[model samples]
Target: MAESEAILAAWDAYSDRHSDADGWPLDEVAYGWRMVQRDSETWRAFLPVRPGARQLLATAAFQLQHLSAGDIAPHWPSHLRDLNQALDRLEELRRGHAEVREARRTSGPVSQEKFIDSVAERNEEAWGYLDTWAAKGHVLLDVHAAAYKAPVRWVPTPAPTTVPARRAGRHV
Candidate 1:
């Protein structure tokens, strides 16, 4: 299996093994914010940032402890241990992947694994950061929608008619 596929499967299996009652699943906001899947309410993946301070994610880093850095980490006592472990394992896997290694070798000047000095590479990095930021709730705005359907009733606003400037003293 591809490295990415393996990573994905590993994450899915790990997440599936956890539950709310068991204090698993970690932070709902810290998981996936780039995917809505078949359920929207379950995870606000594609929604705008909601109102509230995003305690866990203001930035992204390789290390979980460094994820928030100076900022106080959110209160996720029950799941912190597991989350840290998962991040560590994921990091290890990525570091050890042949593709990742090759990508790193291909990266130029300043060093980056996936982000080479190219438009597409930069775009991918930006998207990756956006996804990470969204997951961490480090967003300035977020909007929620119900099924994202067209309006049931269409009522376009009427256009304003141009009113000619009033003539002074009955001047045509």
Candidate 2:
């Protein structure tokens, strides 16, 4: 129960941090170019560059799924076009950012030029749409999270076995 609240709080904080853009300088934020960018809908954090923007697509997947649920906002479908457009932009930006990094790596430190463009632009653009959607349906997250809270799993680790006799297959 507590853990679920923590998760919801963390998710809200993250969404706020990434989407607020009040004092954040989109140009200076390395998240767009240097670090991986996460979309608001997915509720994920920084991820690494990957093949074909799988993480990039996850935003649309989550949004689409949430819309399909039909219990969120009364007008979730209104955001579908924007979400799809954001998906396209995100995919392009991610691919371009990856290519830029590859170019910089191969061209040696001397090559000041990179294949990267205004990554922040695409990132902010995508999040702008997502933020609008989230703001419109802000209640959904809280209500859903509270309603469907799951039990926290506790994984216990085995004690250390530094001694040879303590080995699993050895002297019991």
Candidate 3:
């Protein structure tokens, strides 16, 4: 199986093991995968973390920490442990991803330098996962930004008008 597939499966099983009595068992890996599968447009720059998703990850991570040594399978809990660490840094990655995506939405395709700068302003550990995602074909970056500098055009918005301007430039 592919590494990401294994990661996803381990996360699924890990999350499934921990759902509480008061509520339904949430499969957090599924949630994360669903979010990742969305179109780029759905990702707004600096989009706030989804509360439900965050809670699911936190709960699963908490449970994973208490695993017995026998439960520590190199392909499973160990995988979840790594995923938990990756999930821990997701906020930073999400922010950077959103920033670049939003900039692209508003200005045009995002530049690599701007994306790099945005990533650099945040924690490297966080950016590392994002870069991994990009490398794994889950995301992409502008090659121009990787090469020569370029300008991004602003998206046109309706011009706001003052009362005077609205009234044919006549004073009240």
Per-residue lDDT of 1-172 in model 1, one digit per residue for the tens? 1333333455566566543656565666544431222123221332233222232222222133322322334533223333334334434433445454465567644355244324233223333433333343321121111112213335699887987789788965
The CA lDDT of each predicted structure is: 0.36, 0.45, 0.45
**TM-scores for every candidate against the unseen true structure:** 0.20, 0.34, 0.27
Ten-residue region with minimum lDDT total, candidate 3: 138-147
Off by over 4 Å in 2: 1-73, 110-172
Which of candidates 2 and 3 is the stronger one according to TM-score?
2
Q: Score candidate 2 by TM-score against the native.
A: 0.34
**Candidate 3 Cα outliers beyond 4 Å, as residue runs:** 1-53, 65-68, 71-75, 100-172
lDDT of 3 at 131: 32
**Residue 70, model 1, lDDT:** 29
- As a whole number from 0 to 100, the lDDT of residue 170 in candidate 3 is 72
